[model samples]
Target chain A: MTALEYIRCIGESWPTTKERAYFEALALKEHGRLSPEHVPEVYHFDRTMSLIAMRYLEPPHIILRKGLIAGIEYPLLAQDMAEYMAKTLFFTSLLFRSTTEHKRDVAEFCGNVALIKHTGQVVFSDPYRVSQYNHWTSPYLDQDAEAVRKDNLLKLEVAELKSKFYERAQALIHADLHTGSVMVTPESTQVIDPEFAFYGPMGFDVGAFLGNLILAFFAQDGHADQVNDRKTYKEWILKTIEETWNLFHSKFIALWDEHRNGSGEAYLPEIYNNADVQLLLQKKYMTDLFHDALGFGAAKMIRRIVGVAHVEDLESITDVSKRATCERRALDLAKMLLKERRKFQGIAEIVAVIRQF
Target chain B: MTALEYIRCIGESWPTTKERAYFEALALKEHGRLSPEHVPEVYHFDRTMSLIAMRYLEPPHIILRKGLIAGIEYPLLAQDMAEYMAKTLFFTSLLFRSTTEHKRDVAEFCGNVALIKHTGQVVFSDPYRVSQYNHWTSPYLDQDAEAVRKDNLLKLEVAELKSKFYERAQALIHADLHTGSVMVTPESTQVIDPEFAFYGPMGFDVGAFLGNLILAFFAQDGHADQVNDRKTYKEWILKTIEETWNLFHSKFIALWDEHRNGSGEAYLPEIYNNADVQLLLQKKYMTDLFHDALGFGAAKMIRRIVGVAHVEDLESITDVSKRATCERRALDLAKMLLKERRKFQGIAEIVAVIRQF
Candidate 1:
């Protein structure tokens, strides 16, 4: 069954009447499957509450965060990720053969994904925002909290300035498909937590995935004990970034070529048909998105270290000097990412430098 | 004689009629000595051209760049620069004890400083509209014309941004007062180049001075050949930056206390009475400006080496790799400056780090 139908089943399984009502409403609103013609079968239990049920599909998957912490490598993982991102973001949003109404429905659904509010606040904010989390935090980590706050403020301001950037409604995006939210295998990847999903910058998804991988790679220094393993682990991280970017670009272009529909034709011309112009546009968009990604990634990395939830990197490094060294390197890389993101042309270039670290 | 009158004398001595007319108009507009009451003199210049001039006090001085390059340290140089900048930028703009008419006249005169225009196939446009000085050309220098073109272009862009920033009428600024422009001795410092001056961000001048000094410090690797003298020379450079920042802050606060006069009361109410608040405001401004300065300095340093005119610093390093190392260090420091500028509260912090390098 489709992802939405599976979510409906989970909602129906909730134990209480209030829970049933809340889930049903949430499933409809959050899933954007509210059309009368498309509504799933509604079941009633003891006449107390109504629920929706549907078949669920399970596929080979692994938690991205677990893989990161464990330093596991799956061949073509970066390539697969880039492809997945390119399809979900660039192809689905920019090249989808969908009607305007269909696209709008997707956007509206993604907007109501309250799971983001729940998870983002819980996982992201609790550790950083509360007083309890402030004490006994890493000293190096604490130094970055004010910076994180300032960065957040800046992003909010940028978001305000570029409000129109998200106005062109498009397909549903798996917004929070970073390491924690994505389940991956060799052949297929399943993205969970559609709550943070939204129609936004296509590059945002691409960046989030690749950025997380980079973060994981950098954090290895905190976890790995062997110097030799550290080198190999870091190599894997750089490789992931490079391959991911390459695969994403290739797949994005292919999808655009294969699915050029007439929708939004008046505003955005057929980008695929004109190779020179298309390449130029793609490079420009990618470059700008990369800069944004770098800034956001720095914010993410810094916040995780100091804001609320500290990473395992520093925790694993028992030696204060080593921990400080790793922290400094991570921060140095983050700062470099933010400042020099524009100067980089492709992910390979950036990954190459990161590898040197 | 006042600075304007001295400049007028220099203008009148120019061999070319075009140059003479330019300076003559400059003197009239800049020096309030030629008043609205002297309608005939003003009208004569008005008919001839639109450029304005002003008269101001002159003092014994020498360019800071020459001193830096030559490794000469005049006593009280740092204190002198701080006083000149603090008095000219903060006092004249915010705490001036002058009448409204006099302030207005000065403001108008500042507003009229000429902008350099890009004419024809010239790649680098002059934005300051200052008459080119044949005497100012470096005989010892061998500059790449194309590189110079590129550097000029970059400088032009910077100058344009600076002018636009000034047009907001934010504060009184000595728009152009680099080492070449400012004349100084142990007892006093005098700013020349009112030709390109305007009201703008006060920090721009601070950044220019400090940034240039930092560049010189880095450049000293080549300038002072002896290992021991190198240490001494580098120490001087570091001390200069530290003292310059310290004196500027101390004198700035002192001036703010003496004559703040309710001008910046809106954003800085407590600043009128609270020394701590004033210090914090100054610190924040300095921090932000330092970042910009580093970025600009990096760009300037890099362009000088790779693009057009090379610094004597690299010239002193005969080995290619060594020179590259120095260049690389400058670039690295530039990036570091951009990245960590916000973290620095005092010049000692910067000097400590530079000394480590």
Candidate 2:
């Protein structure tokens, strides 16, 4: 006999709750065509009750963050994650879809504004202002939090990022792409809980994944004890961040080249046909994307340290002083990344900088 | 007794025809709050018939292009036009409205995509590619038109402009703001026929007005007679172009300052309160806007010369060779503006460049 589970929301956030259910169904249906291996199959959905019944990621499968906290290394984690992000993001982007298809889907997803508004408040707005929702490792990092609230240059960069998040619908994005949303085993990696999906800047997705990995890396020091120094695992995390971005960039460009003459409207082959101009267009596009990813990734990191939500990676550490030290290092790197993201040209440079901190 | 005018459409472009009816009503209703003197009051609208009945700008009122062709100058032209552009654009921008109001209007305008598509084709696509709709002066502009079609650098720039036209929803714009769209007299400047109105980049509206003014300046030599060499009229036109942009910039900043503490969502007062950061934000914003206006204006000029639509300022000239010479000068200047708009820092520089040509 087989067992089935149906999930339902119990509170006032039902509109977004229902929307997430709808989007997950839509995404799973579409992503099924690209690569079905990483998405949970939808069995049934009830829109009125905000209920969903689907495949359960049982037993061996565990949240990636939990696995990371336990110092367990999934060797295939980087490759599987890179493939999932590339296939899901690229397939849903204008780089692959027609304008008609793209706009129609964009309009549909704009109804997910309830969730977007929540993200806008927590990730961009609340951290910079005195808000009831905001918290941190109090007393120990009190001055650091106040400094974040008063940093004019950092706020200026964040304003630009917030505008992009609100206005620039460059692609359909899984707005919350953190490690907590992934379930992993030694042989497989599956992305789950994408209720925050909508048409937004693709950099938001890339940044979330990389930013969460940084959080995990910083938390390693807090997790270290006499038995395992955790130095090697930290190196592995750095390598994973470097490899994921490089692989995703190459894969995205490969898709662009493969579909150069396809239905994508942004760069028409007839106009951008010559080798020289095509190369120029690609370089400019990727450079801008890289900067956006860094800026947004830094924003995500800052919000985790001082904003409404605290990550489990840092919260799991028992000692307050040790946690605060790890968090301050992350905060310092994040500030540098947000203000000086444009100066960075590549992911390897970012990895090198991460090691410096 | 008062008379009434009713317009009815008979064909497939009825959606745009109807949208014009809808927007004129919305604009007039809102514009009434700002300045009822410039925009005509809508009397009646019938959606099924795709019709509008509105106030008529009575005699002595003539299309501004005709007045320019006759070498007649209105002293209040610069002030009146600048006021019109500032009031309409600033009031409709996110600088003045709340996000809820802005998004509602933006979504409503997105339904007017048919007209937007027409603009995308005529203004951006046709000139860059060989299309049946494209027409220019035979023999005189045959080579010039061919050069435009083959100019890779020009097309590349056009592609960027096209993307902005299709993507950036910075403000509500009169997408066809040109001299021909204005009714003028010695005392009054009235804007009419905003049938292509939609939520788009504000620079498009600013550029259209200035680009048409530039076209009128180039056509002065063709209108030159033994009785009137038009040397003084050319200087007046140049002064008007320079004054209009400078005045518009000042007035826009004034509005931003006035409403800095208002519901505007782009730069919140809480974050952008300091003088140094405020100055930086304003300078960066206006500079980008200036470049966008110049680029869009140049694209408008190039289209009028080489694309499906030809401006009356150049077309009214009887001699083909004379018309061709005037057009080639305007085209040369426009191509420069489109390619090097960012290099220009102020309005005086643009006026100086115009004088050089």
DockQ of every model listed?
0.01, 0.42
Model 2, span A1-357: residue lDDT tens: 122454544366465566667776666666655657887767777777666677777768899999999988888877777777778777777567765566566667667666777787788888888778889998888999999988888988898888778766677777888999888888878787777777778889889999999999999999999999999999889988998888888878888899888987677776676788787777877888889889898999999999999999999999999999999999999999999999999999999999888
Per-residue lDDT of candidate 2, residues B1-357 (tens digit): 122454434356564556666665666556645656777767777776666667766778899999999999998888888888888888888678765666566666666666677787788877777778888888888999888877777777777787677666677788999999888898888888766777778899999999999999999999999999999999999999999998998888888899999987777787677898888888877888899899999999999998998988999999989999999999999999998898999999999999888
Candidate 2 positional error at B184, Å: 2.0
Candidate 1 regions exceeding 4 Å error are A1-61, A97-99, A110-136, A147-171, A186-188, A226-228, A261-274, A310-325, B1-357
Model 1: per-residue lDDT, tens digit, A1-357? 334344233444423434334444443343333222222233332223443443232454567677667777777576656655665555444334333333334323433334433333433343234345543245754555445434433333222212212222234455555777656555444454443554444544665666677667766776776544666867877777777777777776676655545552211342123455455545655565566555555545544554445555455667766676666666657656654566777676777777666
**Against the true structure, candidate 2 has what lDDT?**
0.82
**How many clashes (backbone N, Cα, C below 3 Å) per candidate?**
21, 0
Q: How far does residue A317 in candidate 2 sit from its true spot (Å)?
A: 2.1
Please tell me how candidate 1 rates in CAPRI terms: incorrect
lDDT of 2 at B8: 38
Specify the highest-DockQ model's number: 2
TM-score of 2: 0.92
